[model samples]
Target chain A: MVFVVVLLTTMLLCICIGSVNIPLKNTLTAMWNTLWGLELPAGVSKNIILNVRLPRVINVALVGAALSLCGAAMQGLLRNPLADGSTLGVSSGASLGAVISLAFGVSIPGLEYAGTMIMAMLFAFLSLLLILSLAYVLDRSMSTNSIILIGVIFSMFTSSAMNLIITFADDHARSIAFWTMGSLSGTNYTQSAILLGTLLICGGIILRYARELNAFAVGEDNARHIGVNVKLVKLVILITVSVMIGVCVSISGTISFVGLVMPHMTRMIVGPNHKRLLASSMFSGAIFLLLADLVARTLLSPIELSIGVVTSLVGAVAFIIIFYRTRKAR
Target chain B: MLKAENVTVRYGDHTIVDHLSFHLQEGQWLMLAGPNGAGKSTLIHAVSQGAPYTGSITLADKDIRRYKPAHLAQKIGVLAQKNNVGYSYTVEEVVGLGRYAHSRGFLAGKDDDGEARVENALALTGLTELRKSNVLTLSGGELQRTFLAQVFAQDPEILILDEPANHLDLVYQKHIFSLIHEWLKIPGRAVLSVVHDLSLAKKYGTHAVLMNNGKCVSQGNINDVLTPQNLQAVYDMDVYSWMREMLGQWE
Candidate 1:
């Protein structure tokens, strides 16, 4: 309840504070008009509200929630504080996938309806598969240190591939270059809905497995001793988390820290139960991202900053605070 | 009965547990007594199927290799000398994992059965009060008890403990043995634990297997196999003198 109230209210404020400066009441009126299929009053700027602000704001919030939730789940699933959407190379994989698609001008015909996000999703999943394979290969010695190493190595590999692709692409492809930095300018209601849909589905899948994840934190042997199929649980979590990160990375580029910080904060508060922690982190991350994105767009007014920059700044500060608090308690 | 016949284990090119054969009747408290490098831990791990080994281990007269992993988990549980929780998991979560070997999939949001088993295990190990505590915050003895709770939750027919008394106070140590003893009394259940403390094995063990240099030097009734002469032969120490010191401390 606290999370819901905070998130809904922050989203309302973020919607009103962006550069075009739509008044809260007028924005609501425009939204209501759009919802009810009613005609806008003559002279009101419907195009600004309809085409630009609403989709962007909603995407920011949804993408933020998705990424943070993925991060929280990854940390718990991998049992490492540093595990996040980007840690697993999902972001770099998505970027490589997108840049390659753009550089080759290779549009999968007809399914163009599915958008570049689909290709990004495929790349992210493939990268996740590689990471999971590394983890499985090291099954007997599934230490947190080993998983962290795998995540870092894979991220580096995918990022180098992404950099290689970027080097060969034309300046026209630079629009996509901002994606590697994580921008939210180009999303429409179509893309936002896809992100929101993926978020809802992945969130449900993760939440459903929350109990298994809780069991997993104890260690693989204990998990299996209790009757959990350790191999199966690890595989499912790896694949599901990959898809979760893929959705976030595809819609918005490599947004960082939300996943790492939000989940850690929630775990610090609620413990590692996964039942409430996943939901709590999702709410906190969404609100956090929406608020950060608002500052990114409106902080300099006419000149926009990357959404990733805002979150990383806030995320870094929050991570230090949480780290200190966790250390003190320990 | 649980039986190990010509069981051999090798790590890399080196043999750790030499061919060993034994049959433990139901409710038998079997103790493996040996020096530190004699592969007592390796033998336990091998019988528990945690390490690859040669020869055959049969439980309830069924070939061990034929059993499914989950089926074997329910039939046999092993407690290592130390357990490390990879994160700040709650005691309940740690204990709850013992149900995984008996459970099918993601626990259905804390089922009544799993919780009941966790509570029962915690209660048995005197850790029911610490269910919500963070495992990392626990003392070494308390952590050992928590892992004991996990093993208890597994409710295996045959239990294996590798230096189970490490870090535990004598009172809790005795309590741990008593809990296992009481559980074994239920019929068809047995325990095989390695012990450096000969007195513990002498007091609680029904059967004893003495090992040296990765081989069993003697095996049989506790009173027979734990004779001071046999212990001296296997451990190459003055067993009578050490036994007297243990008795002195206990008294």
Candidate 2:
């Protein structure tokens, strides 16, 4: 409840403090007018507040929530604190698919504009499958070390492949490079809607298994003894998290560390129960990213930094502090 | 009741539990005793459906594998020797997980029956004061008791324990063993435990199986199976003399 209020306030603040600063009253009036099909207020510009800032902030929040939620689920599923989309190479797989679509103009039959997103999502699932199968073949127990090692190797492989594609496609190289660095500048209502839909569906699936995830805290075999179908739950959660990471990456590019750091931070506050941890992590992630995006755009007045750069900077520091504090506490 | 016939567990040609058979009747507390590599734990794993075995293991006349995981869980509860808890869950929350099979649906609210069971389990294990405490902050004995309380809350017909009190102090071992003994007093309940301490096994077990090199050397009543001659064959030592000498030291 506290997180929800803070998140709402953060969103309003982010909307009001962009390149063209609008007063809080005007922002609220604009939002109210937009909500009830009324005309825009006299002082508010629809293009700046409604069209540009609203969708951008909403996309940031949705992507933030999706990434953090997936991270929490992955960490619980693998029983490894460091597990996330990047660790498992799913984000890289999505990036590869997006790059392929952009470089070669690949398009689905009817959904031409959604080519990158569809391809990215497909490849994300494929990457998770490939990595899991490889890990399984190497070690039947699928030990945490083996899976993480395989994921890191696969991530490196995909990154190299993405570099090769960028090199060959000269015309789209600049755009592809910018996309990989992550941005919310290009997000519109359509992309925001898509992100919102994916977050809801995937988040719902992850939340449904909170008990099973709690069962996993005692180890996989014990979870089985406690009646959790370990294999089925693992499959369901990994697939769902992969879908979420794919969608978030396709829309906002690879925003590193939000998935890895937000969950750990939230776990400290809410304890390790997924019932509360997941929801709290979503709100915290949203607020963190909204603030990060705010800094990225406004930190250097006219020269905008990539949102990814800002997040990596802030997330790395936050992660180190969290790590140090937890270790010290222990 | 539980029964195993010609059960063999293998890991890539190396047989861990070879052609082992045992029966656990209601009201009986069976103890599986062996040396370090004698496959006692593996046999427990096979019975609990954690490991695959070649032969049949049945609960209440039905093949164990034929039952769904949830249904089987409602019948057999296993307390493993070592539980790897990575996160910090409250003691009560961990105990409440034992009631998972009894509940329905993903978003189901807390059941009144489950809450009462959890409360009863906490009190039984003397963890009522620590119900809200983080499990990670517990001592070894307290942690063991927490898991024992979980299995108690499960209310399964057959309780399988692997070294239920491995590294605890004598007081904790006695408390836990007596709790299991008292639990077996209820009709239609049975227990199978793996124990390294021959003395504890002789004291608490109604039936015993002595194993060496994945093969059972003797199986019968506790006194019959734990004979000095059989102990000598498996342990390669004068079993009675060593225990007598240790007892003399205590005196």
Candidate 3:
């Protein structure tokens, strides 16, 4: 009940508090009219709320929630406090796909637009598969530190590849710039609907494994002994989290720190029960990103600063404060 | 009743624990004592089904291979030697995980007395005070006690502890073994522990299986199997007289 209240209240405030000076009353009526087929107003307010600001805010929340939830589940699976979704090179691989798509007119030969996005997501997903499988074959123990180092190496490789694309490609202008920086400006409602549905379905599948996740917290051997098909559960979570983060990064273009900070915050509050921790992290992450978007729009006025920069700065501060406080308490 | 016939644990080309056999009667506490590299942990891991072994293990006349992991967990509770907390879990939460095999999805409110059992486990292990403490902040002795609390909370028919007393001081060690002794008071319950201390094995265990070179050298009543001769032969140590003195003190 508290979570729902906080979410709705935050959404209302986020919609009302952008640079254009709209009251909460107006924002509510406009949103109700737009959503429930009521009446409307004939100004920039409706379009800003519907087309520009609203989508941007929601996209931030969605990415935040998805990334953080995936991160929490990943940490649980890997049994490491510091693990995150992209530490397995999933984000770098996705970044490479997105960069390549914009730098060159590469669309998997036959696909275009949305198909290209899917192709980028697929590339990122497949790269994670390859790296993890290699790690598996090299050492069945699957050391977390080595896995992270593998991710860093893969990121370095892809980063160099990205620079190579930038240097050699014909379109080195604004399009590549926007693709690299990331924005919610281009996507329509159809894309939003498709993504929202995908998030719900995939997110629900993970939530069902809540108890199994707790079993995993004890240890893999212990979890398996308690009737969880250890390999099967791990494979499901790994593939699902990789695909989800891949899709999100493909669209948003490498949003960082949401996964790391959100889970850590939730851990500080709720301990480490994955069921509660996943839910709480999503709630806190959504609010966090929405607030960041609010500051991005209002503080810089007409020339909007990128949400990523704002999020990284503010989130780093909040995390450092929380970490310091937690350490002091201990 | 539990029986193992021709149990052999091999890792790649190296056979860690050689072909071994033992039959444990109900209410018999079996202590496996050996040197550090004598594959005591390997043998216990194999029995707990935590590793693969080329042998047959039967429990209560049913082939252990036939039982799945969840069923096996209910039948046997294993407290591994290590208290390595991979995540920051509270003591209560850690102990609660032991009852996971007993908890079903959306369980009915029928098990009202269950809370008492879990509480009793905490009190027995002397972790009732640190129920909310983060496991990462706990000392090694406290963490081992927490693990024991979990094993008690699980309430399995057979308890399998692998080097459970290593980090504990003598007081905690005696406390833990006393609880294990008390736990096996029921007619059907038993304990199989991997122990390095011969004095503990003799004082608390009903049977002792002295292992060396990955095989059992002597197996029988604890006092008889833990003799100075067998102790020197297996562990190659001069602790036989020292252990006897410690046993007298414990008595």
Q: Predicted candidate 3: what Cα RMSD to the true structure?
A: 3.2
Indicate the residue-level lDDT of A93 in model 3.
87
Comparing 2 and 3 on lDDT, the stronger one: 2
> How well is each residue in A44-66 modelled by candidate 3, as lDDT tens digits?
37876777667766777787788
Could you give the fnat of all candidates in order? Answer: 0.61, 0.81, 0.54
How far residue A126's Cα lies from its native spot in candidate 3, in Å, is 1.2
Error of 1 at A213 (Å): 1.2
Taken in order, the candidates have interface RMSDs of: 2.3, 0.9, 1.9
Residue B163 in candidate 1 has what lDDT?
85
After superposition, candidate 1 runs with Cα above 4 Å error: A42-44, A108-118, A134-146, A170-176, B63-71, B97-117, B245-251
| TM-score per candidate, chains pooled | 0.90, 0.96, 0.89
Scored by lDDT, the top model is 2
Better candidate by lDDT, 1 or 2 = 2
How far in Å is the alpha carbon of A195 misplaced in model 2?
A: 1.4
Please give the CA lDDT of all the candidate structures. Answer: 0.79, 0.89, 0.78
Give me the runs in candidate 3 sitting further than 4 Å from their true place. Answer: A17-19, A42-44, A107-112, A140-153, A170-174, A221-227, B10-14, B55-66, B105-113, B244-251
Q: Write the per-residue lDDT of candidate 3 for residues B1-251, one digit (tens) a residue.
A: 78989899988998888988888888899999888888889988888777789988999989887886667878888888886777788898888777766764465234455577689999999999999998889999999998888878877899988988968998998899888888899888988888887667778889988888789899999888888899888767777677667669978
Candidate topping TM-score = 2
How many pairs of residues collide in model 1? 10
